[model samples]
Target: MCVDSPLPHLDRPFDYQVPAEAAAAAQPGTRVKVRFSGQLIDGFVLERAAGSDHEGKLSFLDKVVSPEPVLTPRVARLAREVADRYAGTLSDVLRLAIPPRHARAEAAPPAEPPPPFTAAVDGLAWHRYVAGAALLRALADGRAPRAVWTALPGEDWPARLAAAAATSLAAGRGALIVVADARDLDRLDAALLRVLGGPGHHVALSAAAGPSERYKRFLAVARGSARIVIGTRAAAFAPVADLGLVAIWDDGDDLHSDQRAPYPHARQVLLARAELEHCAAIVGGFGRTAEAQQLIETGWAIEVGATREELRRSMPRVVTVGEQERARDNAQAAAARLPTLAWRAARDALNAGAPVLIQVPRRGYLPAVACADCFTPARCAVCSGPLALPAAHGVPSCRWCGRPAADHACPQCGRRRLRAAVVGARRTAEELARAFPDTPVRTSGRDGILTSVPGEATLVVSTPGAEPLADGGFGAVLLLDAWAFLTRADLRGTEEALRRWFAAAALARPGAPVVVVADGGLVAVQALLRFDPAWLAARELAERRELGFPPAVRIAALTGPPAAVAELLSLAELPPGAEVLGPVPAAEEGHERMLVRTTRSAGKALALALKTAAGARSVRKAADPVKIQVDPLDLL
Candidate 1:
């Protein structure tokens, strides 16, 4: 019995005697309640055996949670592998893999099998890439071909993925496609309906669904009634029988990373699943991640992308209002958030009856502010946190403590006036609305997101990842305040900024002007101008390799009280050549973080050593548990 306790010491399975009454129901993969540490705890019956492995008498299972086997053998094995890979407990990974049981959904009648789908493989979208057609044909022939695809600008990616799923279904195999968010899920669903002519052939799984509804869809896929599964992050683990294709869109999106323990990325999960199940895999996105490039460099996956000529024909004409423009114009124009050139582009697009997309780095009105006189950042006197204006006429308030800074003053120069240091989507929308009074202006951000907007003349100001689709794409794309993303103190800062820029830029109509407000000399800006993310990704990966950063090597971050962190590191039997970075202060008070780095080949050994050390700590009931994360998203 694999107990559900999260204690690292009890990570392994334990022997349990099944009562005769429950024996029939206590089959492998079924949920059961077993006595552990003198308390009844939930567990999964991994397998049934006639003889006990323990020398002492095994405790009888308290009760059978359900007769329906929810956890499949394949998923169980995958969960175990994922747990080991991340140095996390199997119970934690299982929690993420399996949803809470809804008895009504489980007891409900099985869904009718989907009608046989025989749609011809439409490789129109894939044909743009050199190997796209071959990849589709391989899927149709039931052959697993792993590839890293770079989506072209204005590409109907949802339709392409749906077509791929249909091809796999036609081959008598299942397909699992995981996107980044609910909006993407809806788009994929609509495309699937159009391609497959119905929804019965596949199921869309989302956490936003009600418990019963989500479980119902999950049960359908588990029972082989549905051959294709499309969903957000967690859906990466969807139990699809005879799995053939596993695809993930926008793998760099932060939403793809689970916030819970173990924190496995959807891309990694799908890759692992594909390797384990011997299924085809595709990681396609408008922008490529360094991790994706690593796959190509290692020869683990082939690159499927368009030629330079095809890219030039499909991508928009990119312009950067860089140092040359600043020199040509005045300093004021250079300082302006929406410069003269950006204004002209928006005006030209609006006059042509096409919507203009303005990509803002932040979401609120004034995310950051500074003193007008000395240009010093405004901070809250109470908590010393940065003060921000929530609205145009709103008083400045502490973002951290939520206290209004009614009598705020600059600590450096004692200035009372504040100026907008960082303009957000709302403020940018307001500015554009005033500038283009005749045109309708819309904002898509945290306040409210617009999935799609009419292609008519308008100003659509949006934050990254919330850009609304425009009919025939936007007339022009404006990437505003590039510094906000470019200057972030994170390892993936430039990569993330480029990803957001490419995603927004890809929404522009063919040959439309996509203006970026940044220095032309920057590599990221140059990549955007050329619309070649793979090159930038490759360069970044090479740099990471030289620096011994992630993708080239593996690093595990341990964060907790300083003493606790030190204790864990001391107890850990680090692999040979492993280096331990600083136990520096963490974001949380009284806590520090230490990073353990090792070569890519020794990543598994490093994880195993950490897992063993953590288990030892758990056995000893060590105080102050340290949070262990492998390949943490943010590395300062």
Candidate 2:
């Protein structure tokens, strides 16, 4: 049985004698109670054995916790594989795969079977792709092909994916789809319900659902009552029977990465599942990441994207407004918060009876503050933390330590007055309110995000993803404070900025104008104008390959107290050609981090080496704990 204990030394399964009362219930996949180290713990029955391998007498199972199988045999094996891939314990992966059992949920009636799949319900969006129809055909035939699809903005990708799932179901196979967040989940769920003509055949698993509902849906999949499962990151491990397809939407999103131990990314997990289960895989998104591109280059997945002519015909018209263009008009207008080009676009859009979308990089009021006289950034007097204005017409306070800086003096200018250096969504809304007093100004962000805006001549100021969709689409879009995004210290800064720009621009009606307030010479800006995310993604992958970065290689991050971390590293038997970075200081006091890089082909060897070291440390009862994260996204 796979025990509940997470101890690395005891990661393997153990043989257990089933008592007379529990033998009938202790089937493979069922939960049972077993004694380990003088304590009773819950575990899943992996398999039935004829005899024990250990020479010592095996202890009898205390009792059977549940007669129902919580995990399918395929899922149990897949969990073990995922654990090895992430250099994590089997118990940890099981914790992620299996939710806490609820007796009430188990007693619920099985979900109704879905209506027979009909080809008439095929998604219309597939017609726009170059090979979308063929891919759907392959899925229906259970061909187990893999593809990396770049979905067009404003396209009904959920419908397309749901149609694919329908095709799989028609073939008497199951499908599992994972998306980025609740919003995506809701959209996909609605689309699936429509495509399937009902909801009883599929389970919508979401963390936002209460424990009872979540467990009920999970059991539906585990019990083979649902042929399709849709959810967020955690859904990647759903125990769908006879899995024929696995799809992940918006793979670039951070939410797709699990935050718990092992920290397996959704895309990678789904890819692994496709291999293990011999199923088809689809990694579809509006923007492509370097990892996805690598899959195409490595011949592991095929590429599916729109042709250049189709892209130009479907995408919005994009224009870049640089400082030089803004300065040619008037010096005073150039120094204004809104550039001359943006001002004209907003004015024109408003005049044309269409809403204008203004995307700011940050949220809140006066997110960044500086001295009025010398323009030096304001900081707290006590702790020297960066100061910000949380509310309009309010005193500035430390963003880090919460100390007020009402009477603060700049070190450079010794000025008491503070000025706004970086404007936020709320501040932008206030300014737009004053600029066009008669027009309605709606703000969208963390405070109260609007899902959709009414079709009207208004200003919708939002922060990135929080931008509300305009009915019939907006007439114009303005991407403000572009430098804030393009100049980030992240390796994917340009790629991410272009993604945000494309997302906001896509909200505009076809042929509508999109003005980006940044230098036009940037390759990212060019990619945005051409509506070619694939080009930018290819460029990013090329650069990473040249630099020996991720997708082209594997990286492992180890973090802990310096001495403990060093000891762990010393004990690790790194793969051949593995290179060590540094024991750099971490954000936490007395803690340090280090990175190890190896070729992609050697990733498994490196993971095994690290797992061996961790297991050895656990057996020795090491005092210090070191966190090992493979293929880490956030190096900083």
**Stretch of 10 with least lDDT, candidate 1:** 327-336
Question: What is the per-residue lDDT of model 2 for residues 22-118, given as tens digits with 9 covering 90 to 100?
Answer: 7789999999888888998988899988898899998998888889988888888888888888899888998998888899888877776656565
By summed lDDT, which 10 consecutive residues of candidate 2 come out lowest? Answer: 327-336
Report model 2's TM-score to 2 decimal places: 0.96
Tens-place lDDT per residue, model 1, 1-636, is 799988888899899889999979999988898888888889999998989768987788999999888789999999999999999999999999888899999989998897778767676888889899999999999999999999999999999999999999999999999999999999999999899887799999999887789989999988899999999988988889999999999999999999898889999999999999999999999999999999999999999999999999999999998524543363433333477788888889989999999999888999889999999999989898988999989999999999999799888988799999888788887877766768888999887899999989989999998999999899999998898888898899999999999999999999999999899889999999889999999999999999999989999999999888888888899999999999688999999989999999999999999888898899889989999999989865
Q: How much lDDT does each candidate structure score?
A: 0.90, 0.86
Off by over 4 Å in 2: 323-336
For residue 340, model 1's alpha carbon misses the true position, in angstroms, by: 1.5
Give TM per candidate.
0.98, 0.96
